[model samples]
Target: MTFKYDVIVVGAGHAGCEAACAAANLGSKTLLITMDMNKIAQMSCNPAIGGIAKGQIVREIDALGGNTGIVTDKTAIQFRMLNRSKGPAMWSPRAQSDREKFIHTWREIIENTDNLYLWQDSVKELVIKNNTVTGVLTNMDVQFSAKSVVITSGTFMNGLIHIGKTQLRGGRISEPASYGITEQLSELGITVGRMKTGTPVRIDGRSVHFELMAEQLGENDFHKFSYLDFEPRKLKQQSCWATYTNEEVHRILRQGLPDSPLFNGQIKSIGPRYCPSIETKIVTFPDKTEHQLFLEPEGETTREFYLNGFSSSLPLEIQLNALQKIPAFKDIQIYRPGYAIEYDYFDPTQLLHNLETKKIKNLFFAGQVNGTTGYEEAAGQGIIAGINAHINCHGGNPFILARNEAYIGVLIDDLVTKGVDEPYRMFTSRAEYRILLRQDDADMRLTEKSYNLGLASTQRHSLLIEKKEHINHLIEFAKNYSVKPQYINSGLEQLGTSPLKQGIKLIDLILRPQLSISKIAELIPALHKEIDKIKNRKDEIIEATEIRIKYEGYIDREKMIADKISRLENIRIKGKFDYNSIKQLSTEARQKLDKIDPETIAQAARIPGISPSDINILLVLSGR
Candidate 1:
């Protein structure tokens, strides 16, 4: 029997889960198909979520009514705000989650979401008609019809696992590789490429000598990934341990290099440059004497620990020997050896910014299947794909994010515009408007947008408005409140800042590099009274206020620049001209323009090899 739905999402990893949820929540009848129900939204690589720019992506996803941030906050066993010493734009929230609980939590949510249904099956083929995807064909011979199909196949498509000279056909350690889909898409004239990524070994925490390693503790602050406040972390917090590989450890790894699959001419796919395997690290940075590794807890109750920076694909014995050389790991015992996996990915340039495939109508791709490496990156793309798929089915404009608006925008724009030569990872440096994309204000930037699209709930929009009112009130108070030298002079001296020479506006004191809103509140009773008015979300309000007051100039400057550049974005170019026939354009420009078919002049400018002269020519042709 054939089942029908408004949307069908293939694979239940981070991307698939978000895509299915977004579509269903937007009133579409959606089905989420996965190889195994128990492993929905599995943290296949790191047990943690969010880091650097990835944390920003998670917040944007949350603001846009996605479940990843909520799930992350609920299951978090340890939470830390990274790069606190730097500017607020650099600050990112990262959490180590209860792995088993994370999966269970996601399963519960997916099961309960309105209009969403889950099927335990592997999709082997797409049921397409006239370049439009109608549904999927499962390996069990069941055909499911859908108006739109989102394929978030992750690392499962034609996956090959490598460890030393040993190779296996699997998506993950014990999971079987998915077949047929990649070949079918390739036969349909879609461009397919290979990418490689690796995970580190799981260690027995009981065998670890924690005393020999430096302990890194988690902070119990008000900060979390989700904007909506939840009850404080319920799981018992755990500390991660840091250790380093010594000369001896490096020696052992070097001795096994010949047997490593990464080096033995076995794996040819390009891997993530930023998150290279342990073997690659040693070879690339040979002059270095040591490399630091973090031992993180896999769950609250489990004794399993994951080695953060020690990814490898060496022989099992070689991996064990290399770790055993480190003092904390002198008697190391691993649950399994780390292995590198290569999988098939479609060229992301074949996708629209909304994640819809350029070749197939109503077909979308996200996550590793689109050449991205992180779970956060995958989820960000998933939410957009889900939103656009719903729009494609119903009557609405396709959803797209601009680079100046979000890190998710930057990620999608980069993927579809430039394409990926290796596994793409998110970094703060990747975003040109990161100042406008801080973790503290994702809700400010995206909640209303999602709410307008009927994705974010009314409650979320109300919360965002409330938070903004509180922040604006606080900023107004700081601007008007005056502080006398007597009131803050002595306190300023104690804090190592120069004493105030005369009375000043509280905002002036707040602008001081050494003074914070919290510190000012401690010094001035009137300011403190005004701050107390915001009792509902005191810390969040104060932090957001501080960022606004402190970086007002920078924020305004970036917005002005973003607005100026956005003018080019308003120029429509897609299907506007036959670029190949435009003899005035360079050969390379003609080919790239005709290939990418950029939607706007701004997007065309961002495309590699497209020069200023080409853009001017296009502008002239368009009578700009």
Candidate 2:
């Protein structure tokens, strides 16, 4: 059987969802093919979304009209803004989600989309002709034709799961491994490598002694993930409990370390260094007598609790013993034992900045298949890949986000240029222009671009324009409007900040380290009145104005640096450029350049062993 679609997206995880939505929403007849329809957008590991730098990527996704942030808001059981004590740039929004609800909501949204269709089958092979992807072959030998394909296979390709000495062919606990595609791609001369990731076990929440664990509650005043500002759902919130593992727990884990696939010669793949398993942690941090374990509820109603920070592939008996030794988990019943899984992924250096495979036109890759590890990171890349695929079919220039513009840009740039050896994760430190790429102003930075691409709705575009206007109006009012010593000095003094020495503009005072626009609104009635008049939406106006004033200098400096680097980025190279012909280039640089096939001079500069001399030679060759 043969079917045709304008765009075909493989996998129904976060990345596939975004890619399907983006293409479908942008008028492509899109089909989202997956192994299991029921597991669409399933939180296979943690039942949470957004953290640290990951939150900014979610906001950016929201700005670009992706469904992740909106879906997260709808399913969240608890909400918190992490790093609130730090500067606004570091403040990130996080939400604990109802896992079942999250997946159900995602499926509902995808089903409701106009041009999107769903197929329940594993993609077995890519039907490529003339060095471009034409379609995909399903498990049942059905040919699904499309002009472009976005592969977000996400740990299912040749997956192998380990539980102590026993091993199985599966993606997660029960999901079967996908086959044929890896071998087919290898035949196409694409390089593939294995990477391992593990999830923590689930335990009976009722069995844990709550009295011995510290309660970790959500923030009193929560911020929603979406910029759309949909009415917040009123649901009973759930709290997660925190306890620590004692030396006894470590001892139990140590007993099973010899059989661990990670430690033994069984597993050759590299796991995420930052998110190590329990055995690795115990072995690496030997001096530490205790390690924290968070007991997070799977849902508001479910008795199941995810055992965070205790990921392992130890024997079931050993895992139970380790859990029993934890402070509050003495009588805990195991729901599932933690296990490690290794899967195939392509090196992202094989992809261009547009997320299209360098070896094959109109074939794009995103999410875990591209070596990225987070839902938000995957979703962000999916949106970009979807947009670029649509553009590619329509004969338009590929859309690329600059590093200074959004975190998504930094993520994709890092992936395509730097080629991760292990599972890649996004962090604030990765972006030099992070101050300017604040989560608070993602709509301001990216909504217009989305609008131009037709991904953003007219109403969203209008709202973004109106929001910018409101911000400018408020900035002007704050700069010109002054508050007297009597009206604000008393409140300012109470905040441990200095009192107004003289009549000061509200904007000038807000620029101080301690004072905030919200505080100013609370103190002076006139200022509050002015703020209310200019800002119809308090959250957007406050966050946007605060970031603008607070980090203005750093933002400006980063922008200048970004501009200089962007010049190098603009120096494009022909796809057939000869790296071996350059005598002045180092042997290592030549090999690395050939491997990565960087599209620009700036990308070449970021490679590990490439030097200034190699870059200069490329610059001369490109006539820059």
Candidate 3:
């Protein structure tokens, strides 16, 4: 069979879904090819979405018109805003989703989208011609032609799953490993490296003694994932049980360590240091007597509960023995054993800012294939790649977000500039301007860009405009209006905060760490009415307003710093620039610069060990 499309997207996981939606939604005739239609958007590891910096990326993805946030909101059984006790910059929204519903909702959205077609088959090889990807060849010997192609194959390229001494050639539990693509890419001179990630065992919830474990419930007031208004599900929320690993659990895990792929020198790939295996934790933190394990529900109706902190690749008998050592899991029935899978990924530095392969035009890569770890990170990259792939085919400039703009920007910039020695995970520390890139204002910052790119709907664009005007009006109103001691002092005292001695602008009062906009609105009826007009916008808008008032000085200072760095970003390096010609440049700097072929002075500066002297030489050579 022979099919043609403007963009061909391989794999329908979180990344592929976003990639396909981005391209098709932007008017490309896109084809999404997956090995199994039923497994599209499957949460292979955890049932939850968004956390820490990852949550911020999801909001940004939603603001850009991607489906992740909407899907998460539609399927979430419980919701919570993480880091509420911290600064506004740390406030992130998270959701515990029904695993099955999450996947189903993604499929429903993708299937309903016009100009997006689906194919059920494994992509075998890229049909490259003269260093440009023309299409893809599938396992069935079918050819799907396209002007551009995006590969978002998450942990499926030559995957091998290890369970102690037993190993299998597969991706997830039963999903077959994708073949041929790795060999074909190798033939094209792309270097591939292996990396491993593991998931915890699933136990039958009915068999576990939950009473022995501490019940962890969702917050009283929860926030939805999507910025858009949707009816919040009022279904009875499920509770996760918390237990701990005793010395006995460690003893059982130790027995399997000698035969473990991670310790036995059988696995060559590096694992995520942040999320280590049970054996790894035991060995590394030997002084600590125990580790916490969360027993979370996989779904409302399913009997399976995920063993959150017990991720391991130990043999089945050893895994069973270890679980029995936990307080509540004495009678637990194993639904599936946990295992680690190692797969191939390309060094993201090999790709350009647009996520297009430097070795092959019209070919883009995203997700774990680009050495990123989480679902949100992969989806963010996928959306950008999909948008850029569509634009590339139409001969338009690619949309590139700077580091100051978003967490997505930080992710892509780090990948393309610094690259990754291990799987890349997003954290607030990774972004220097994180305070300015808070989750609450993602739509305000990026919706206009999405609208300009034709991805956001006109209604969304108008809504964003209205939101901006309203916020501006509120800011001005707060700045102009002063609160007298008589009107505000009583409420301030009631809340246990220091009473106001003199009249001050409402904005200045709100800038206090203890006082919130809502609290002030409760005190003044006029200010209350103004807040009531936009109360439906949720904590996100209020938080944005609050941060604007409290951190305005810091935000301004950061923007000035960003402006200085952005000058170097604007100084583009000619593609043909010769690093070898700079005799004064350090040998190490010259070798690194020549190898990476950085696109701008900003990117070159970010590369490790590229000194100020090397930058001066490059700037002089480039006539900047």
List the candidates' TM-scores in order. Answer: 0.99, 0.97, 0.98
Candidate 2 residues 389-431, lDDT tens each? 8888777889999888989999999998889998999999998
Q: Which parts of model 2 have CA positions greater than 4 angstroms off?
A: 220-222, 534-536
Q: C-alpha displacement of 622 in model 3, angstroms?
A: 2.8
Candidate 1 local lDDT, 1-624, one digit each (tens): 999999999999999999999999999999999999989999998999998999999999999999999999999999999999999999999999999899999999999999999999899999989999999999899999999999999999999999888899999889988999999999999999999999998999989999999999999989989887557898899999999998898999999999988888899999999998888999999999999999999999999999999999999999999999999999888899999999999999999999999999999998999999999999999999999999999978889999998999999999999999998999999999989999999999999999999999999998889899999988888889888998679899987799988898889989989888888778788878888887566898889999999999999999999999999999998998999899999999999999999999999999999999999999999899
Off by over 4 Å in 3: 220-222
- Cα misplacement distance, residue 19 of candidate 3 (Å): 0.3
| Native-to-model Cα distance after best TM-score fit, residue 204 in candidate 3, in Å | 0.7
Pairing residues by index, what is the TM-score of model 3?
A: 0.98
Superposing every Cα of model 2 onto the true structure, what RMSD results?
1.6
TM-score of 1: 0.99
Candidates ranked by TM-score, best first?
A: 1, 3, 2
Clashing pairs in 1: none
Q: Write the per-residue lDDT of candidate 3 for residues 268-303, one digit (tens) a residue.
A: 899988889998999999888899998888887888
The RMSD of every model to the true structure, in order and in angstroms, is 1.1, 1.6, 1.4
Worst 10 residues of 2 by lDDT: 530-539
Question: Clashes per prediction?
Answer: 0, 0, 0
Candidate 3 residue 24 C-alpha distance from true site, Å: 0.5
The positional error of residue 118 in candidate 1, measured at the CA in angstroms, is 0.5
